[model samples]
Target: MMNIKETIIFAPETFNLAETTRSIEVAKECSHVFHCIFMGYSKKYSYLIEESNFTFIHLEPHLSDKQITQIMNVDQMNGIKHPFTYEHIKERVQNEKRLIKIYQPVSIVIGTTLSMFISSRVCNTPLVYIKPLAYTRPYFEEGYLPSPFTSMNLLAATIKKLFISIALRITYKPKSFTKVAKEENVSLPKYTIDALDADYNLITTTPEISQVYNLPDHYQYIGPVYAKLDVPIPKFFDHLPTDQPIIYFAMGSSGSPNIIVKLLHILSELKVTVVCPMKRMIKSQLHKLSFNENIILCDFLPAHKISKFIDLSIIHGGEGTVQTACLTGKPFLGFGLQQEQRVNINQCVRFGNALSFRKKDFTKARMEQLINHALSTRTIKEKALEIQQVLKDINGPENAAKFLIKHFTVT
Candidate 1:
């Protein structure tokens, strides 16, 4: 007799590479026990789901390039410019309701999908969120979050923490979100962070890096789920010599091109070889600037796979990038662009696994000093390798799947 597998809907914001990949990895782990259906508005990363042999349903109200940019701006705390209009939210809710009726999912899983927070509750479906440790309530209460502004003194830090505490206590729900919730007869989320709440909130980082304690009963650690891109190795790696130290420089999708350009100018003069994947960000400036013989530029390289060849990494402190570096047993020098990234990098710094600097502290000499220091340091490498062993013992995706299957009742 064949036992039927219950349905589980995975809603990931496909515009963000890390979010999409994290969902895909976990879905792959859950595919055996659950019939996974991936739903999203963006088709940019649809191929990732398709390649993994999952059923992907493309939703309506597709986002434009400008709208995607605005969404990113909202995430970076720039402004309230986004595509979540009242009509759009209404339509999205309708679509989700339709999916729930048709699929009868045991649970709706999401990674940074704000719409699901409302829809899942309205539909009475269990919701599971794969989130970063930095966003958890315990992390916020710890006051480890630093201000993104240039000021790094005690007074400025204290004011920022106070402001954040106040904001978290107040009701800052979006108008469209409130309207949709009201129409559905569902209670609206009082605070902004309430959107991140779920029946099960799985933190995607290890305890050593986060160091956040006293989590709620519902929140659990699932280890780090970093990108393991399935791509062929670049041929340039063959020509590079092994005698010199190699540095992997990646300013992820959210990093600033201007900062990358400035750092490149300094790196060009160094004796170490630099393998930078910045073609997408610096396409217009590539022809104007001449590259050194030691520097190699490419469109992309799987950072997890190439960690063996590089001595150290210089990156914008993104969650996925930081986890990848730690998992691969390599030290990194992080330059965080936003508050979340700052917190991620700061956590690593606390663990003595990496060093970091702010954008305002950028200098030619400072960059050179940090790069040289990271490359020459033995303690950082040992600590990173130590964390790698810890990460290896726990498979984040598999554990997350097990937790979901055990906790939720399949209909």
Candidate 2:
């Protein structure tokens, strides 16, 4: 019931809402000028989809958790497997092929530049990659202001890069990638990183967080894209002390529930006031747990809204949450739950505005130490102010939307 000529296909390859949120903001921002048809697996973020302002196409072949676990079992890193396999890509292609028949789009939007690339190529549509992270690796060149994110010397950084490169080389079989190419009836470059080659690379981090590096002209660095909601402040927040800075805390969905519970209990005794937002299940069980009035529990309130009112944020190092914290020039304690998160939080620490901890090594004492450390120092806030101005000058959604419209305008 929509014009195929005006619609843009936005297909998120992965299931993580953290990454999907970037495209959501961009689409909502520009949905007036251009119609965006969201195409993907639905069960990933069914909660927010109903409330979101966009049309969605549920791809064929629903995947149960058990099926997802089996097909995606090989070469698990950080003890977590990626969301794709030879079989998953085949299903995605079939679904996309069906979508093209119903509504031919002007162009296709992508994140992580994975399985969808094959379909875009077949349709002869321009593909736009919207990355929530910086493509630039932290360079520890001699005499340069060492980026603490890596905590490595030039040699160490190089070695780490090589090691990771090797890991990527062996992570999947050549036949797995080639099989997708065969399905598309096209030849794809051998390397996995080649997937990044696109009509445009819309990088979504400020240059302040990324190391200065020469990139292809197609790569444009837009600042962080954050979604805003108009929700009323909870009455519980008003009861907390306005006298001093209150801690904004979120453990994220990645942590073990038991570990999360233990950590929350230990953090409850802090002398300073804290605001923690988490799942309803945890909030329901809080009656059995003990916490002072100083620590307040909340359920899925808008983090951006709550961000402005808080002095410091403690997060699980997801891109969207970290970006939200930075936009406000607020200091934070980042507890990275996985490799991707560890890298993200490491950059924040290296940027000199935040603290980073690995979930494996992060203990209650370390959490207390970092919280006190971030609050006590004015330098953290000062450093955050440095990036805050840069982010403010950069309009993430508008710039990205305009660029896409221009590219597909002539189509």
Candidate with maximal TM-score:
1
Clashing pairs in 1: none
Worst 10 residues of 2 by lDDT: 135-144
Per-residue C-alpha lDDT of model 2 across residues 378-405, encoded as one tens digit per residue: 8887988876676767778888888877
Model 2 segments more than 4 A misplaced: 1-5, 65-76, 80-85, 133-161, 164-175, 243-245, 252-256, 280-293
lDDT of 1 by residue, 1-411 (tens): 888989999998887778888899898888888899899988877788888888889988787768887887787777778899999988888998899889999899988788787889888999999888775566777635644522788888778777668857876777998888888888865677765688889988877667676688888999887667778889777778788779889887776667788888778887789999887778878778787787788876788788778888888878888888777688888887776787888888767778998665477677778877776788877888887787777888888999988876464
TM-score of 1: 0.91
Give the Cα error of residue 347 in candidate 1, in Å: 0.3
lDDT of 2: 0.67
- Report lDDT (CA) for all predictions: 0.81, 0.67
Off by over 4 Å in 1: 147-164, 281-290, 409-411
Worst 10 residues of 1 by lDDT: 141-150
Quality of model 1 by C-alpha lDDT: 0.81
